[model samples]
Target: MVERQEQAASDAVMTRIGQSVMLHHAGDREEARGRLLDLWTEIGEDGDPLHRCTLAHYMADTQDDPADELAWDLRALSAAEELTADRPAGHEDASAARALYPSLHLNLAADYAKLGRREAARTHLRRARTAAAALDTDTYGAGIRTAIRRLETRLGENDPDDPRSGPPRQRS
Candidate 1:
């Protein structure tokens, strides 16, 4: 009964968050972030890590500096790591939670690049690629492809003549 009640509460939270997402997509960032913060507070400490990570990302995206973005990305990555660690050994493939790792890598890479840490940026890009490869193919496969392409573009290894938009992916 308690589990069901908790699930219901979670559902309500997700519903409200979905509304916030809609607001965010419509350019009402301030409103969305405000609602998001309210929801974050409601979720409490033991709430879902994914939601927390998402809130962090949203907070950063709505911020000014790219370093602020990196901060949120790092927090999300830490949450993903914690989620992975908490999973039992047998079902160690709790990938939906871990998908945040690659995003963190990408964000960190971008930050390093902005700060002129070329080697560090490349290293972070590679780390992102590695994290992406470990993701579940059935779900995050497309995201992994996107991340690889983005990393390739960042590394300047991509051909300028390539038709690809954002990133160039070297398919394995």
Candidate 2:
């Protein structure tokens, strides 16, 4: 009975999150951010790890500043780590958290790159690539892989030590 109740609560939270995501996609970013912030307050800092991870992941997207986005993404990654640590291997939640690692690392890589932390970005990019092997070959997975490749190419093009690489180009 307790398990069922917990599942119900999780489902409710996910539904609300989905609705907010839709609002974001529909161009009501401020409204969506407000809704997500409300949900975060409701969930609290020590809420269920899965819920926290999911919420923080989406919350990162709604941020206006890159630094804020990085902070939220870091929160999401921390929650995912907690979720994986709390669950047994092969548990559904553990598996789900593992699945999130690639994207989380990828986002971190991009954030680090934006901040001109090339070595940090490279480290996260490698982690992302290694974790990406777990991703399925679906459109979402393909998109991430493509983004990783693009970022790698861009990073390679901006080697500060290599004068031949030239000045950093503007991000598209």
Candidate 3:
């Protein structure tokens, strides 16, 4: 069926995205971005949401500009939202599509934080937490939760009223 063929193509794109992520992790950031950009050109902005989500999510990490990073992360989030809306439960791609949401939101929070958008960062962080709750406590879920905790700590440190920001200053 057409759906199965589409799934196959989407899965191939995800595999390529994974390879690009590996390249980025291996310190070939620009090369990784180049590969992803090629994939994006092939997939187009309105292509399979699963492919777009995976590509954009990893693409954000390769960006040198905070604003560009935020843009890619936002794209990933948008694709994820579309995937959730379009994928029906029990559909072949539904589980795989749904699994991207928590990390997509988490990346958005990080991107917003990088751009000093505190309120936006906090909002996306909360969304990430909510999405994470639906994930089973496997390796992926644990990693997402850890990233959320780390980002929360970083955000709290910048807030003067946060108890975890450290003890109050002693009188001079």
Candidate 4:
């Protein structure tokens, strides 16, 4: 059936993305980026939303340029939005896609912070926190929470009105 074929295709794309992520972990960012780019071209922008989300998420990490990273993160977020809109409530795919929003928004916040877009970073950080409420505080969720806290501290330090400001405090 058409649905089965789509699921298979989506699985294949995720496998490829996993391989590229391994390549990235092995420190061959350029090769990983190349592999992701090839996959992106194959998937196209309008491809399966999950495929787009996974690819864009990894592709963002592979970018050397902060601007490019932000662009890919945006793509991931956009694809997640599309996935959310397309799926009916209580569908497994819908739940899976919803699970990605926190990480996607977190990455976007980091990217914006790197680009010196404080307001944008704060906005995405807030969204990430809101999305994270649906997640249990397991290892993955804990990691995201840690990252959120780190970014919050950093942002707070830059705010003159923050109690944590006005001191050259070292980050742990």
Candidate 5:
């Protein structure tokens, strides 16, 4: 069992990390990205792959350079795959990973489309739709649904094609 002293130290470390994350989120993209990279390195491969995956997604979205975006995607996808493999079956992390897989696939498909890999893009898009449909209130559920709807709409397939694709949500 971990000693109380050690546990407390770990808690302190996490608290500091959490504070840093909050600061970043509070109107500081440059600071946030810098801090995120530092935290990403500090946490290493052991902390949270999904966290890294999310960070990578943000990085990819913000990177103006195509090559850098691709690099971020590869890094995020690698982390997600590795973490998912290490997690036990039916574990919450694994379940979350399953739910998030569609977004990764969708992003990959977009990249493939940009690269003119039509076949690969189509294959991944199909996987993304399937995974998104299987999701149930995952953190990425709404995003997945939105993305899937957008993709379908692009192919001339959103059922209503209304301003709001799905039912309304409580305004945050």
Candidate 6:
């Protein structure tokens, strides 16, 4: 019964997060950010790790600044790590948090790239690729793989060690 109640609460939080995501998708970025901030305040720093991870992940997307986005993405990754560490091996929550690692790393990689931190971006990209091995061959998984490849190509083209690599180009 306690577990069930906790699950219900989790579901409620996810639902709210989903609503804010919808707002973001509709281009009401400021409103979405506000809503997510309110949720974060309600959840607090020591809230359920899963809730914190999910909220922070979405929060990163709504940030206008690259530094803020990186901070939120890092928060999401930290929460995911906490969730996996707190749960026993093979437990559902642990497994779920493990599944989040690829995307979290991928987002962090992109954030790093945007900040011109090529070394940090490469590190996270490698982590994302390794973590992606656990993903299923669905559209979501395929999309992530594609994004990873694209980022890899871009990074390769901008190799800092090569004098002919040229200046950094803005991503469309």
Per-residue lDDT of candidate 4, residues 1-172 (tens digit): 9999978877888999999999999999999999999999999988888889889998999998999999999999899888889989687777788988889998999999999999899899888878887888799888886777688777763333334435545657
In order of appearance, the predictions have TM-scores of: 0.72, 0.87, 0.84, 0.88, 0.64, 0.88
lDDT (Cα, tens digit) per residue for candidate 1, span 65-116: 7777677667766666676787764543346566667777777787778777
Candidate 2 per-residue lDDT over residues 55-87, each given as its tens digit: 999998999988898899899999999999888
Instruction: Evaluate model 1: give its lDDT.
Output: 0.70
Task: Decide which is better by lDDT, 1 or 4.
Answer: 4
Residue 151 C-alpha lDDT in model 6: 81
Cα RMSD of all models vs. native, in order, equals: 5.5, 5.5, 4.4, 4.7, 7.5, 5.6
Worst 10 residues of 4 by lDDT: 157-166
Name the best candidate (by lDDT).
6
Per-residue alpha-carbon lDDT of candidate 3 for residues 22-116, written as tens digits (9 for 90 to 100): 99999999999999999999999889877888788889889999899989988987887787788787665567767877888888888889888
Which residue runs of candidate 4 sit more than 4 Å off their true CA positions? 157-172
Q: Roughly what TM-score does model 1 have, to 2 decimal places? A: 0.72
Better candidate by TM-score, 1 or 6: 6
Which candidate order results from sorting by lDDT in descending order?
6, 2, 4, 3, 1, 5
Residue 46 of model 4 has an lDDT of 85
Error of 6 at 6 (Å): 2.2
TM-score: model 2 vs. ground truth: 0.87
Model 5 ranges off by over 4 Å:
1-28, 45-48, 137-140, 155-172
Q: What Cα-based lDDT does every candidate model obtain?
A: 0.70, 0.87, 0.83, 0.86, 0.67, 0.90
Name the regions of candidate 2 deviating beyond 4 angstroms. 157-172
